[model samples]
Target: MTKQSRLIFRNKIFFRLWMAQSGSSLGDWFNHVALAATTLSLTQSPTAMGLVLLCRDLPQVTLSFLAGPLLDRFSKRLMMYISDLVRALVAIVFIWAALEQQMWAFYTGSVLMGIASSVFGPARNATIPGVVAEKDITEANSWTVATSGVLSVVGAAFGGLVSTVVQPAIAFAVNAFSYIWSAAWILITKWKEVTREQDKEESSSYFAELREGFTLLKENRIIMALICTSVAFAIMSGPYFVMIPVLGDLIYNLGGIGIGLLYVADGLAFILSASLVGRVVGNNVTSAHRWYGWGFVIQAAFFVAFAFSTNVWAGMIFIFLSQLGAGILLTLGMTILQMTVSPEVRGRIFAIDHTVDTGVKQLSLLISGPAISLLGSPIVGMIVGVIGGFAGISWWYVSNRERKNVSQTSEPYQI
Candidate 1:
């Protein structure tokens, strides 16, 4: 590795957290591929497939209001451990559900996994800044984003291959093991116990605390813009989950292999964008925001191209290009959020981000399901592509309008 690449690992705690992130992320994709394939196979209905996706997303939408305050009031480290442990146990149950062909059980397991993940994700995001210097935020986020991307490729391909050749039950078992590995890392890492006196002072009634998170969202113009743009991008990309499997099975007729290849392309792009673009935008909020703007434009263009492509390989290339944009937006957004926020409220902010991203996508998937049935995937893609195009334009306008205000009002973040 290059000297710059080694910099993030210099913080041993950050390194440990990265390892934990790697294990859980790998398991996430493993479960995703296996569960998606299993759901489609069991029900053989597009609506059922969408419903399965809904099960995994619904918790983030509904529970984030509560999860936000809980994360802020408690130990993020403890939360991570508990979340991974629960997910690990749930993965075992997933295997049983798949084996017994109990569709309801499978959905229940997925819902449980989603609940665990909702807590884990915000906790992980909130924890990063606590362990690393401000100077290293970009490098640290790059490492995390790249790691997630690489593992996604591995997990998706492995899950598809195993599900196709051996069995999906095997994939679930692998996921179960990965969660255990993640929890083990968390167990070993020594973390400072956050004193609850500060929390107790800040705490109010549950609804009051929840409203405080929303208050922060309203006050922070930049964060609000980020959330809006993120929602737009998420809605535009919602068809991807539904289309990948449907296109693989119905259009390309390559089944799991086709879906796996597309996922690989997306993952490769994510790795490249996060590692390369991440460093280029380092420590400069303006630069990061600019990249985010361009990323949306790129995604809008590619979404259209992907929809039009007939050949599977050609479509994969389009998917790769689109996800590159996605990677840039996602990584930079996280970095910016971390650098900008006070640690006390970071968890709640990230929780809101998660809620908006997942909730909007959930709503989009609901629409995509029926849209695909009536209008077909390509037409649906075209429609979302147009919406993305408009969103990109709007983001540019909003970003420019807010830029002067944010720069003047923001406090300097120190290492």
Candidate 2:
């Protein structure tokens, strides 16, 4: 770790939260690896596997009704651990699903876990500024992303290994344990959220609070530009991950282990990009825009390459480069959002972000699942990949104009 990053770990609460989430996130990959492998093993259809992803995303869309205001009005800290606990139970349901080979149980567990994650994500993002100094936010997010990269590799590889040698049930069990572990650590992290006067009055009505947040979309061009970039990435994301399994299983003729290795490559991208991504966005927050565009352009190029790859080795290389770009996009995008939004409306803004991101992604999943059967993964992926490049260029241009406009009209935006 660098001297700058040393400060984040120096805060015990942040450290514990970081460690706990790292473990929890790793478990999430295990669940992902297991779910994909199990679904393929049972159904023998890539479309079915894509539907599994759709099931996981549905709650993010459906439950936005409750997630936004609850996040703002309730203790975000409480929401965090409770989400963890709910997911633990959901994991147990997955274990039963694996044992019984019941597809419904798996889908049900996915929807339940999605509901839990919907709350946890905003709560955690909204909670971060409360834990550390504003200046440390970039490095703090880097470590979080980096550690996730490391854990994802471990989780994907080990989850693959367990599914291949032992059973998918074992992987499901690990996910359960990981959630319990995260909940325990989260309880130890003390998060103090101060309610602003505007927050207090708005707390009286959910729609009023929600409407207050959506108003930012019209008022802030930066948020609008970010939303555009987010949608492009969301479009890429739906096909990108869904097709990875198709690449491993059908194209490369690799089995469960192969699927896992493909994800390991993606995880490695995050680990490789995290430090450099942090440095790029460090202190000079405005720098994130150009880099964000470049990240997407790079990812877009390699995504096409990965889609047509003929061998596992080539596929891994393409996937790694593609996701390296994605890692940059993800880190920069998240940090910019965190730095730009205030605590008063942070949850609603993030909820809107998730809703838009997931909504687009779900459509991608809906199309790609069947398209993979018709046009094949490469064509489906290529179409989306080409669009991503344009999105990157357009988003960068818009953001620059928005920044100039905001600088002219208003006070500066900061976390």
The TM-score leader among the candidates is 1
Output the number of the lDDT-best candidate.
2
> Tens digits of per-residue lDDT for model 1 on 1-415?
7634676557888888888888878878788888888988899986787687778888888887579878888889999999999999999998998899989987787789889989998898888888887877877888887887898878777777898899889999989999999999999998674422444566577567778889988987767877888888889866877887777667888887888788888889988987777568877766776777788888778877887777789889998998888787777778878877777787788898888888888788778777888998778888877877777787777777776655687755221
Give one digit per residue, the lDDT tens place, for model 2 in 1-415: 6854676558888888887888899899889989999999989998888788878878887776457777777788898899999999999988998999999887778888898988888788888877878777777777777888898778777888898899999999999999999999998778678444444554457777778788886687777778888998998887886788888888888886678789888888888788887666775766777888898889999999998998899999999999889888888888778778777777778888888888888887667777888998778768978888898888878877777776798676552
Q: What is the lDDT for 342 in model 2?
A: 77
Q: Which stretches of candidate 1 lie over 4 Å from their true place?
A: 37-53, 98-104, 193-203, 245-257, 376-379, 406-415
Query: What's the residue-level lDDT of 245 in candidate 1?
Result: 76
- Alpha-carbon local distance difference test for all models: 0.81, 0.83
Q: After aligning candidate 1 to the native by TM-score, how far in Å is the CA of 126 from where it should be?
A: 1.2
Q: Each prediction's TM-score against the native?
A: 0.89, 0.88
Residue 218 alpha-carbon offset, candidate 2, angstroms: 2.4
Q: After superposition, how far is residue 70 of candidate 1 from its true place, in Å?
A: 0.9
After superposition, the stretches of candidate 2 with alpha carbons farther than 4 Å from their true spots are: 1-5, 35-54, 93-107, 196-203, 249-261, 372-382
